[model samples]
Target: MSTNHEELTRLARTLNPQIIDEFRANRGKMKNFPGPEFLLLHTHGARSNQPRTTPLRYIKEGDTYILIAANGGAPRNPDWYYNILAHPNDVTIEVETEQLNVRATVAPPAERDRLFAEVVRQAPDFAKAQKGTSRTMPIVLLECVTEKD
Candidate 1:
């Protein structure tokens, strides 16, 4: 099915709280799903301070959340990426049950290459995404901070 951004945004705004509640209640797992569609929330821009949330394909590497700034193979990086770069200190992530205060940083070149290889092995679209754009896609690592108990 073709996903409509406007309709999805409207529904997300209207039903996010409830959907989040359900996701939390299920222990971060969406049970009644035919696939992996109902999994993540929109991540807003921090520097421009705009409400732009794209459905990101992610995977956990150790204790970090790994994301790619592929922008569907666009020549320019996504605005959210620059926002994170500008305001690396003030970043927040909303998971199914928990909201995390995070520090966003771009992975180093060597590590990014390795991680990109791993991600492409899993989700081959990333390879296509790289081929679609002239610019090199960035791999970002979001590290969660733990507060003192």
Candidate 2:
């Protein structure tokens, strides 16, 4: 379904705490929530410079994790998306109770389309969301920022 800014903001405020709690309590598994798996993404705010942690559905591709900036199909991108764009160097991720530094990058255009299609194929709700909005959702890759990175 198409989402508005207010609706998305409200939903985030309401659901994130619970999701984060459950993800942590269960060691990164959110039981019945949508998608295959999840991670807690910590990013510095684009404007405020404050840190924000958001629970998000993800698909793991080897060492990288893929995220969709769907914002429940909102017209605008999620705050986390802009945050990562602004401070790509200052992001971290928590998965399976393990915290690690990570860097965010927008998947290349062609790859984004392919990955988006793959994601929609796996999660039909995302496909519904895509059909609900005009904006092109971003597909982000979060790569571990190891010492050698």
Candidate 3:
């Protein structure tokens, strides 16, 4: 992780658990948190195979949830991005009170452009975060899946 990424992760580590607890306590709604809607992303470590949960801001589009690997605009993508890539099929996400079995996919170019714009429009802090980095932010979609699918 880059310095900025490390700092951001440290902050997340310190704060996300509390936020997640509060969100669950409130039955999926968040109070007094910065940014837009958030979800609890449950994934395994890419290499360690250990379970990890991350609280990330998300956008809902139909049945899929969209996330940005913004890492607060760090030079590199966040660790969860690689974890999701490594175990795309085994991911679970909690939206408010519901847990969705999901698969991760990078949005296509046109959709990436439009969805990213929609996210930034809804949460401008993401735009501010992207301004500090040169790499294009990755838009990740958590597409819902059934046992048969």
Candidate 4:
């Protein structure tokens, strides 16, 4: 609550439409980003169960995509957090030009620390976000679907 998340969320709300449009239009090559790279997280609402999508920054771990709940030190967890909690296996992501079905899981604490360290290694501003927040940002693992699944 003591970080830039409020302002960042405000900006994201104002610009998400344009960013989403450009992301789709350009096949995931965003044009006017002021921060990190983004991916589209598709999920259903926690309460309404309605479909939803949000733009997010992510890191890759082998084939899995790691989504940390850091909205540049967002004031609160995004709605997608609740959505994934309600529907963990029912998730998808739009990465660049490809649409992927994925299952979501929140990493346990130790794993979160490790994964977060890796994220900060790749995108260091996440460290700044960490410094600003009292809460531990959740690390969401979007495991890819397989034919067996």
Prediction RMSDs, each to the true structure: 5.4, 2.4, 2.0, 2.8
- Tens-digit lDDT track of model 3 for 30-126: 8887668879999999999899999888988898899999998999998899999999998998988998899899998898989989999999988
TM-score for each prediction? Answer: 0.69, 0.92, 0.92, 0.87
Model 2 poorest 10 in a row by lDDT? 1-10
lDDT of 2 by residue, 17-121 (tens): 999999899998888786668899999899999999998888877898999999888788899999999999899999987999988899998999989888887
Cα error, residue 105 of model 1, in Å, equals 0.8
Error of 1 at 22 (Å): 10
- List clashing residue pairs in candidate 1: none
Between prediction 2 and prediction 4, the one with superior TM-score is 2
Whichever of 1 and 2 has more TM-score, that candidate is 2
In candidate 4, how many Å is residue 75 off?
4.4
Write the residue-wise lDDT of candidate 4 on 46-113 in tens digits.
99999988988888889989999875665577788989999998898999998898989999999999
Query: Given candidate 4, what's the lDDT at residue 108?
Result: 94
Ranking by lDDT: 3, 2, 4, 1
**Regarding TM-score, does 3 or 4 come out ahead?**
3
Residue pairs with backbone overlap in model 3: none
The models' CA-based lDDT, in order, is: 0.69, 0.88, 0.89, 0.85
Choose 1 or 3, whichever is better by TM-score. 3
Q: What C-alpha lDDT, on a 0 to 100 scale, does residue 51 get in candidate 1?
A: 58
Q: Which ranges in model 4 have alpha carbons more than 4 Å from their true place?
A: 1-6, 34-36, 147-149
